[model samples]
Target: MDQAAAGMQGAHRAPVCYRHPDRETGVRCTRCERPICPECMVSASVGFQCPACVRGGSDTGPAPAASRPRTIAGGTVTADPRLLTKVLIGVNLAVFLAQLAVGSSLTDRFELIGQAQFSLFSPVQGVAEGQYYRLLTAMFLHSPTNYTHILFNMLSLWWIGGPLEAALGRARYLALYFVSGLAGSALTYMVADPRLPSLGASGAIFGLFGATGVLMRRLNYDLRPLVALLVINLIITFTPGFNISWEAHIGGLVAGVAVGYAMVHAPRERRTVIQYGACAVVLAVVVVLTLVRTAQLT
Candidate 1:
């Protein structure tokens, strides 16, 4: 100690705070053992520590947890509002189960057979009647005989619905979904055989794919994966034995892309207004086409 003091006297030097280098300090951090000044000191287990050492943590420590995740009334987590997606999946499952209960009768009634003779379940035999609801209901129906149809559709729903719903929010997402389906049905109603029935959410799912691509492009993300997906699905749809509805896919994809584009291009200042307008335009076109097509379905 005397020798050190003699050396210090010769040079006029002492240990200094690591953080505040201008201030001379006799104290060192307990954790890092770095010299520290009063201003830089933080209370520690054994002794005072430098502020940096406290921030860095010691062998036995990590900073305390930050504030807890927030929740809303009814214990809903406010961080993500994916409620719409869940409701959609639930409804699809419920409808699928109902199909199972009704057996062969379900597909016969709900499948889109555009100008087929109508009953209570499908009450418009001719375009003269307003059985336009058939176009919408057809989206919810799937082949009761082919389990894979509903399986793949629902899986796609669970996979894609969450992200899309989150991006678009509840109302817009629902609009996209129903409109996409209606577009597919509208096209199917016009182009497909009135005798050959079609069913499934593939059309709506295709709409999501198109919407995803447009939104991605707007957000400046890579779109090759989606493009590849579109190609693959189209190939599957057209493959001879697949017996998929290419008409629905085309209609839904077109509608979804249109909606997605408008949503993407909308000005941030009035995004909601423009989005609603875009949806209205898309729906108006689909409805008018349906009316015109139904009128011609003689």
Candidate 2:
């Protein structure tokens, strides 16, 4: 009877996870035999291990190459994948607010225009006059007069940017975005009327669209939905009354596809080099187009 009571007391005092002192757990690290909760468990050949054991060699050492978590584009896995996307949206919204407060004062300096003098006495202002930053700033600006311009673009960015950020990771995703936006800006400068101004997140969003298409293809997802959406957007872009910049759309889409393809398909051994090399190539195209347009305008 005394032995039975002792056994009962021992059972009540069952081990708790070392890492989570408050939680009781039957699981233990296979290597270290330390009690571990589910959250601390890492799959091992024989059984689960604690995170410390999974790190290999020592409790505080770096994980082995085989053990490190990686994203589809070889970026480190992060807790919050959509952080950068949210930041980009916030920046666009903030810029739009500035446009509202300041009007053409902000728009005139940032919107992509080849070259123009607003009035007879006004100083010549444009990329041709060395306001080259317009190519970048233009991607974040939207039509303050048209609410739907920012609305639709922001929605698209939220929807597409989140998943793409997760897949490509932050650095690669940023590279894809800037390169695609610049591609759009360059193409718009190359072909559109010099006196006309163009600005929007459409180019960057379209780049995300193309990248999303490539990612879907890589994952063997349903392509029909993406195709239908692309067709609809293309129709809207070319519609006579809309006055959308088709050059930006086409440029962003092409750049997105090219960069995204490299991001997802590059061999693991040479992934970083190949992925960034593709971005550099597209950026070169943007620079070339910009230079040619500037030469012509001047």
Candidate 3:
């Protein structure tokens, strides 16, 4: 009988507390699985244990879980590190160099290579004349006669694109850029001297400004500097001695603002659908106007 009692005592030994390694524990915390001494333990409805164990117990507990910290306004937050503006600049520079390589003058090569849907070399023109690839080719062409055409456009893009791209993300910003450019081209085709071949990214850059304006307004951000810069550029646009596609600029600006409003200001859940729909609607309108004007000219 004495041997059996000693064996039972050894088998029934209490667990050691993790917090107080040297002390024996009578209960355990359900959440953390740490043992607790009776003095450190809390009176849980189910059993005696540590304060942490009692707090975490599931039996109609009065002590609630700790509250999470809230984000405060003006608090510094990390931004995404992607550099979309630099990538776009690199692409434009690469294309410009390629144009220079193809011909002695960058101007001459750009004239031949730039997107002119109605131009003699255009694949779409060939297709209409019964030939097919000009639809895609038209997107690459830049103005052959004017160096400032691409220079100013690129400068504007460098200025406004970095911040906007960082805010909107790469894919959305790129879509806006391309759509705005296409809108500008469509406007130029409709209203300007079509016989005078035109190419450049100014329309898209202008669109960036428009989008920036809308985003600033929506976010309650100050846009005084941006507005001032835009005004100075506009004055330059109208000045004599420089050939500027004012039509393209205006078209791109309108499209950009519309896109920005839809994408940035609209509710988050519906943003994608609304942004794409807005772009499509604007493009359709521009295309219709261009077709109507073309019909009138012919």
Candidate 4:
């Protein structure tokens, strides 16, 4: 009897996730009571529930529309989490290819500049000349002569963007990306020499880095890896020979962290309002900075 009891006790082990059999998880679906890994879990009104329960309806019947599943940022959960990231990458690549085929034509017109003419005959152009579209267009461009520039930026985007898109969902992720990029542009316009041409996706990538850090913190994940990577990037940004735009990087990171916090930490009862309201506040700041800089340059 004693031996049998000991064997039974030894056999009783913590449950592994039903979907991902290799992953051990203490968390169980509130509806179905099956173990679930983080990837298989869905945010629920009460406790985390397995995706099956979330999709198949509760024991009482289909989950009401009011109780529909949502992402951490209150965005609707998507079937293809990385779709937006892929599209953004595609757009960047297409723009880059156009830059290559068209020589300096595309870049000269679109690259961010405060106020400058590339040559004596070139019509005076830039943000100060009312070409504010440069702020948005510049982010889709890179040094046409440097293949490595776009290569590195695209790789970083894939590495950081896909997971972020999954966590925040398409709408929230898109807003974060564009706002972060714009924040970088606004700061570059404000601080960097307006006459110098500036272009790259590093600012947006750095923004993703900041948001990823915030998201990891929110989920209680180990942050050492992200911190180390960010440290390296910062070093590259500030290193004397790199010629990187520290202003853009800093601006994007700060904006990303701020927006990411609002997305993850907002009250459940008012998540959408708080999340979008935070984005609006950031945009307002960006607008103020742009106007101040334009006034200085013009």
Q: Which candidate number maximizes TM-score? A: 4
User: TM-score, each model?
Assistant: 0.69, 0.79, 0.62, 0.87
Candidate 4: tens digits of C-alpha lDDT, residues 1-298: 9999998987886578786687655678888898865445567777677656766754344455765556656666556778999999999999999999998878989999999676766665999889999999999999988898899999999999988887788899999999999999999999999888899998888889999999888766668999999999899889998778899999999999999999888887888899999999999999999999888777
Cα error, candidate 3, residue 59 (Å): 35
Point out the higher-scoring one by TM-score: 2 or 3. Answer: 2
Estimate, for each residue in 67-162, the C-alpha lDDT of model 2 and write its tens digit. 764556777655687899999999999999999999777988899989976786555599998899999999999998999999999998998898
Worst 10 residues of 4 by lDDT: 55-64
lDDT of 1 by residue, 1-298 (tens): 9998998796866666675588665667766788765444444434555534544543233433332111100011223556877787788888888988978666665667777565666453522246666787888888777888888888888777766765565667788898899889888888877767788898898999998887666544557977887798888999999889999999999998988777656654566787778888888888888878777865
What total of clashing residue pairs does each candidate reach?
0, 0, 10, 0
Each candidate: RMSD: 16.9, 10.9, 20.5, 5.0
**Decoy 2 TM-score against native:** 0.79
TM-score of 4: 0.87
- lDDT score of model 1? 0.71
Q: What's the lDDT for residue 68 in model 4?
A: 57
Candidate 2: give the clashing pairs: none
Collision pairs in model 4 = none
Q: lDDT by residue for model 3 over 1-298, one digit each (tens)?
A: 9999999997987677664577564457545667753224333333334544444534333444342110011011113413667777777767766766675344432331222354355332221231112222333455544566567667877878966775566667778888887777777766776555456777788889999898667544557988999898788778887676787788888999988778665544565677778878877886686557646654
Candidate 3's TM-score reads: 0.62
**Superior by lDDT: candidate 1 or candidate 2:** 2
